[model samples]
Target: MAFVIHMPLTNTKAATRYAAELPMRETSPGHYEGYYTATSNVRATGATVEVRAQDDYGNTASEIAKGKLNIN
Candidate 1:
């Protein structure tokens, strides 16, 4: 499934400089992977994973994945 992850933005400067598009990789049919490396080390709180899908006709849709991230 295609997904969008909204990682919390901590550093204002980094947030402002954040890339507008995430470079996604296709793992399988209709599945994609993307990653973000924080400019600084920080913990994640209330993190969530969002999935999106689009058709050749230019129609699109999205949904949030189930689960939480535990970084220690």
Candidate 2:
């Protein structure tokens, strides 16, 4: 089965290192919901937050969601 997940932007800042541990919770069969803090600092003016997921069988998936913070 394929795993589905989503993360809404919780917070954001400019050029600062955003720190937050992703809290992934199993919501349903092959589905999860949580958030992961991006460890990398924002380098440019426009960049989206990306997340990756992997299953026990080594299957992997990724998605790029809108980041909550913006650097001016």
Candidate 3:
């Protein structure tokens, strides 16, 4: 099983690059999605997902999501 992460980008000028600690998927411009697949042998409890955004002008922003999912 896989958990999907959705991060919405409201401000464009402030965010030019998107990166996630997990695998990153670009659903569209300025939008990103990722999957949780760490510790395949153990069940995933409360996990934290971080999404970072950086602009060319050196501005940056980040968002974090924490939740528990059944992935056994």
Candidate 4:
């Protein structure tokens, strides 16, 4: 099973603690793909974006992605 995940932005400031609410859509069995528009403006800094996936069987998986938001 493959899932296509899309994030609006992959950069955030160290002082910013914003949530990236992504609306996920199931494209196939055990697969999902969706894109989320950034609701908040993140400051220019280095930060880590964490992504988690939950299955119907209560199984959870997570991945850490790096982001660097430029603060104007």
Best by lDDT: 1
Backbone clashes for every candidate come to 0, 1, 0, 3
TM-score of 2: 0.36
Off by over 4 Å in 2: 1-43, 67-69
The model with the greater TM-score, 2 or 3, is 3
TM-scores of the models, in the order given:
0.60, 0.36, 0.46, 0.41
Residue 71 lDDT, candidate 1, scale 0-100:
44
**Model 3 scores what on Cα lDDT?**
0.47
Model 4 residue 62 CA deviation in Å? 0.7
RMSD to the true structure for each prediction, in A, is 3.1, 8.3, 12.1, 7.1
| Best by the TM-score measure | 1
Where is the poorest 10-residue window by lDDT in model 4? 1-10
lDDT of 3 by residue, 1-72 (tens): 112234322234454245223446568986777654334344444544556666679786776655644444
Give the per-residue lDDT of model 2 (tens digit) for 6-68: 322234554224333355677898676764343355233454555567779998777766554
Candidate 1, position 68, lDDT = 73
lDDT of 3 at 27: 88
Judged by lDDT relative to the true structure, which candidate is superior, 2 or 4? 4
User: CA lDDT of each candidate?
Assistant: 0.63, 0.48, 0.47, 0.50
User: Which 10-residue span in candidate 3 carries the lowest summed lDDT?
Assistant: 1-10
Q: Model 1 residue 5 lDDT?
A: 54
Residue 1 in candidate 2, Cα distance off native in Å:
17
